[model samples]
Target: MDDELHRRLRIEQARALLDNADPRQAVMLACDLLMAGVNGDAVVALAAESARTLPAYDANRRLAAVIDELGLPELDLPTAVALIAADTCERILDCSIPAEVGTHRLYVVGYEGSPLDHLLPEVTALAAHLEDDLGGRADDDLRTRLGALARTILDRLKAENPA
Candidate 1:
């Protein structure tokens, strides 16, 4: 499929999922990806639009927290994602996740031996989210901006060993 067409398709799928207020993991994942900077304002808007329609229950309390966090004006999604990537990388150096899980996640993205490969999942999720929601409407620089974020996160690593 054409890149643009694929992007549009994902956005539509995500939007429909958001608009319907379904109680499911797909909706939750979409919202989380959006929070992580998938489609930016479109994800934000669609999430907010469907908030009240979301089924009210104890299970939804977690969703409520995510939705509430998204509403905060102080959080910049791209920067936040970069910060998360950097923090997760640090955690690996610090032995946060069990070694097996960490390696699998990192190896999936960092096959080129790039240190910042762990950011791939979040970035991939962002791209997936971007594919559907505002992705179709994204400016030419969206990819560039996202790439810069990954670079920015990597820069913060500042290897003390100096290779």
Candidate 2:
């Protein structure tokens, strides 16, 4: 599909999900946009719009949390996290599944990989940084597990796009 068409579809899908109070769906929709070569700023803007329209909805909150966790200066943290976690797991699942499926829907706008895929490293790094910031030390086994996971992800990325 064309970029404009894909973006419109994503926005429409996102709107429907947000209207249903599905924050996870909103996040996934944002991710799909990112994967489709939508600008990060645009994706963030769409997410912000969803949050604004669904102020009382939990999905709005969760999406805000993810945005905050991404360190976007425009987003608030605690409030977003609270909103996201308010819903039960089942509701979260409903929001998440579509987003997960939509991940594969990419467009050849520029880069060869999904922006979300690249953010995995940033997520892991942030987790480690937070662990250190909180003075919460992981056991050796946990550290090993995390390291292994990092290496696995890196290896996969490297294999997929050799330098």
Candidate 3:
């Protein structure tokens, strides 16, 4: 097969490994791709995509090493937003994290000039409300709202990049 075909196969293999939560194998395959001259950006992008598949906690632990090895500051903007949104949504929906924590995560995703920048105002307002409810009395309502916002953010991201 031609070199291009070979590279594509490697890329697909790496993707499959990551999708299956096999970060170790994915990282090894990514290294091979790098040695074979695959662009570092492409490798990073592929590895970062795993955040969408892996549970948030697991993705955070696993992807950290890959990010460090690749020497990137963080995943690209869109992926970072998606990961944060997904994580916050899951925690809120399950009532696993406090309203403050979910609010903080949403705040991070709505940073100035981020892909979710348009949500900055709303997120900031929600964060303040969450802070008021930090005592846990109003947690359920806040958590539900936060979860809905997170779901909206994730849906927007998916609609934008439908692949």
Candidate 4:
């Protein structure tokens, strides 16, 4: 599909989420709309035209700061997955790499489910944890390898420590 159609579909999806999702989910969707330059003001303007209070406005406002600080990529699918996994690993493993590099191999691994399924809570949590990697994106082959590696590592750790 074309860029305009894709963008419009995203907007429609966000709108549906705003109407039906819980606060946390709605906030994330709202942030996405804002980032896409989807006329957030117009979206919420009818309620209070002058104030321009978009749905989940407070959360989106906070997210704006996060985006400004971390910087989102033009194509964030693979980047988001790698970064999230890396960041999560960094936290869970007491990993030696910089806070930006989860478990060190996280950039070339798996964490995110799929871009097509990004609206899921798990995906969002992964992205947020990535607040800290992404020297590369996580493609399917890489994700598969990473998944097996992660399982092996987890099994070894469990066996060694019994925790």
Candidate 5:
């Protein structure tokens, strides 16, 4: 696909992931969008929206900082995903959220009464796919891999949800 078309697809995927309350998927989608060179504003908007929906997610803060550093109103998908991975790394090393219950807590925070609650399962499934795709990939290739994964996830989500 052309760069513009790719960016648009990334944005749409990001928005869908956010609406589905899948911050992880949204993060991946944001990475793809950034890799595609979508406007930073669009990226930031998706990050902001995800942040708004999941206030407890620290990844959102990192994404916001990246957006500011890039001097964009929002972050693109690639940048957003990178920020998320960084945040994940920090959390893993620091044990910030209490490893025993962090995943459970995140699930509760993400799906509790949210309009996108119904998508939580799909998001979890997608995250698993992303984890697999990200394994053994070089840093520079991360964005490309994420972009492809985002497209696959979006397609799967659409097929299941059909809207």
Candidate 6:
């Protein structure tokens, strides 16, 4: 096969592995792609997008591992927050994850200096209530608030992409 065809095949395989959320295989293939002269930014973007399909903790952990393997800088606080927010919102809205679990993950992730802190006052206010005890004990009020925030983030993302 030509080099371009071979590269395309590898890219397709990487996408398939990522879609399956197989962290180990995906990262290994990402490394291979990098070694083969694929763009690092593209690989990182693909890895980050795939991480969203996982549970919050798992996604963060897996993405961190990928960054480490790629010799990238540590995952910054704001980026981590964004990833967790996007994951929490997407999973909750799709009902793929329970509201309690999603909120608990959000509570754990914390908003801190995230873009949400500046862009969404509601998130900062909500962050005040996010204590360690919020896991199984999350209230309906928390769920409703989180759902609203999730919709807002998703809508914003859609507007930004619009593709």
**Could you give the candidate ranking by lDDT, starting with the highest?**
3, 6, 1, 5, 2, 4
When 2 and 6 are scored with TM-score, the better candidate is 6
TM-score ranking, best first: 3, 6, 1, 4, 5, 2
Question: Tens-digit lDDT track for model 1 on 69-131?
Answer: 446323333333333345444444555653333333332333334445666676565555455
Model 5 per-residue lDDT tens digits across residues 25-136? 4555556656666547646565555433554244444444444544545544443333233333334345563332222222321333343345457445444444565452
Task: Report the candidate with higher TM-score, 2 versus 3.
Answer: 3
| Model 4: per-residue Cα lDDT over 1-163, one tens digit each | 3464343333333323222212344344444455666444533322122223344454344434333333432334443343333334434445243333333333323334432233334333333444323344444443444445444444533454463
Q: Which residue pairs clash in candidate 5?
A: 30-77, 30-78, 31-77, 31-78, 34-77, 34-78, 43-75, 44-74, 44-75
Better of 3 and 5 by lDDT: 3
> Relative to the true structure, how large is the alpha-carbon lDDT of every model?
0.43, 0.40, 0.57, 0.38, 0.42, 0.54
lDDT of 6 at 114: 56
Error of 6 at 28 (Å): 12
What's the lDDT for candidate 4?
0.38
Worst 10 residues of 3 by lDDT: 12-21
Q: Write the per-residue lDDT of candidate 2 for residues 23-49, one digit (tens) a residue.
A: 445655666656656545645655555
Model 1 scores worst on lDDT over the 10 consecutive residues at 12-21
Candidate 4 Cα errors over 4 Å, as ranges: 1-57, 65-75, 95-163
**Model 1: how far residue 112 lies from native, Å:** 18
Candidate 6 local lDDT, 66-149, one digit each (tens): 445556544455555555566668888887877666655454233565555544556545655655446445577877887887
**Highest-scoring model, TM-score:** 3
Write out the backbone clash pairs for model 3: none
Model 2 segments more than 4 A misplaced: 1-18, 45-163
Estimate TM-scores for all models.
0.27, 0.23, 0.50, 0.24, 0.24, 0.43
What would the C-alpha RMSD of candidate 2 be, to one decimal place? Answer: 16.2
What is the C-alpha local distance difference test score of candidate 1? 0.43
